[model samples]
Target: MKIKFLLMIGLFTGSIIYAQDSLDTRPDRARIIGFSPAKNTKNVNGMLIKYYDEIDHEIKPKKVNGVGLGCNGLGIFFPALLLVSIPSIDNWAINDIGGEPLPDKMNKINGMQLSIINMEPTITNGLEVNVSSNISAPSVTNGVAVSPLYNFHHTTNGMAISTFANVSKKCRGIQISLFNVCKDSRGIQIGFWNENEKRKFPLINWNFKNKKS
Candidate 1:
């Protein structure tokens, strides 16, 4: 019958060229383009072009339920942005860029991240605000990390604030600081110098193991 209508138009032109080669190999969904400053173009998602290496090489966007503005999310690779940074140091060389760090993967950032100066990230679950430093990675933040000077982390579950320092190696929750260190603390440390190799308190420190209910 005319060779089955030329084999059904060659299977509909090979399914429209395999659906345009699967949408050009998927991964691009954030577009608001207008400002251009060079063009390196990769896979960008939402609100494009505003300096910073032309949207920082654009590749992050495995998921971003909503909102993302940037000056430094450190050349994102993956983190599901809800990111907002606008006070640059341009990520402070971000793990020493251009040789070993080019979105060298390992960004979590579930939601809420506001930065004005520094907000390093290797992992973040929710809420991380910075004015100076809120560095992470070694263990990384789970939730809530605020900063005025420093709130470095190696492992923190929740709550870590800093006016001066709130370093951590392992803290379950809460560590407000004028200098609060931790090698291992279960919870609570609000102070003008509260350390914990096991327990050292000048203002307040806790191991907190009360669970009988």
Candidate 2:
């Protein structure tokens, strides 16, 4: 009976080892596969021109500044999205490569380019900032450009601000704003890179309070 029990244990151990080996030998899941990350290069160009033309048309004696702010805001959002989505992409890359290490160049997303035309920020009470970034403007190659976000964080009076910009030559201006307000005995925190992982620090934190809203 003891010999039979030992044989069963050995078989179970062998099965577990084989299962682990099979998983190890499996191919990785896909993350990114293409020439570039942007969606439709030509369309991106068209969008840029369209945005620029609209802004130029809307330019008047009174709304010139407004046009600029609109452009800046557009610029900021594009990059923010890219940066925020990188981790997911990396995970896919790992899976696709079957746990094989990524190439030095492809390990981290790079070659991100951006151009901002007529970006202006309007600050209110030093705590709030209004901005615009042009997404489409004319490019050197006469095509539209797509930019990526790197890092940005701002805070005032316990309020926190995060920004993402989409700067391209064709549109000549567009941006997105992420504003976090903290008031009434509240506060805020900001983090970056690996700081957000490992349960360390949050990228952005805040508390809001009733004010002159």
Candidate 3:
């Protein structure tokens, strides 16, 4: 009986070991040890030991309910409530091999993003603060984007303030900058120069869709 119990224990131990090995082999479950030339070629959900260029396509956390740090090339698919980075490139969306827009599989960031240089997320749903410039997403932004240099976006639903210039295809909220340009302006624009498809106005411009009486 004792021999049989020992045999069962051995089998269980082996099974556990095998299970762990299997988990480690998964493409998304693998952790990045350091700067790996081979691993950088694929997308992974893990911790990066150091910063690398390919990290934009590699290191990503599955989910972030807490604080996270990204040195550079941090590609995040999931919403990071609070993400702190020092001069990092975030390629949350997948681009074509030729660097063209895919449109359908755009990435979405749902929290506060703090960066030093620039932010080019597919979509930003919260506050995006950049020390230098904020590059608008190809799709849309539903929150606030603040930058000292410039801010650009395809569509903006909230507010965008910049020191130099603010450009957008369509705007539904407020835009404050030295120069503001929008294709379709539905709200208020406060700047030195405001240009819209309707007309170009100095100091301030606004276009409210006429509501049917």
- Candidate 2's error at 156, in angstroms? 3.3
Write the residue-wise lDDT of candidate 2 on 1-213 in tens digits. 999999999999667645543444322321121112112211111112112222323321111111111233355565455556644312322112212221122111122223333221111121122222222221111112222232121212222223532111111111122311111213333433111111222344333333355
How close to the true structure is residue 164 of candidate 1, measured as C-alpha lDDT?
A: 65
Best by TM-score: 3
Task: Put down candidate 1 lDDT per residue, 103-189, tens digits, no spaces.
Answer: 444334456545543232345577766554433334266888887666666678999987866767678989987767776678889
* Candidate 3 per-residue C-alpha lDDT over 94-168 given as tens digits, one digit per residue, 9 for 90 to 100: 121113342443434456545543333345567766554333235466889887666667778999998866777
Per-model TM-score, in order, reads 0.29, 0.20, 0.55
Report clash pairs, candidate 1.
30-45, 30-46, 31-46
* RMSD vs true structure, all candidates: 15.6, 23.3, 12.5
Name the candidate, 2 or 3, with the larger lDDT value. 3
Q: How accurate is candidate 1 locally (lDDT)?
A: 0.53
lDDT of each: 0.53, 0.25, 0.54
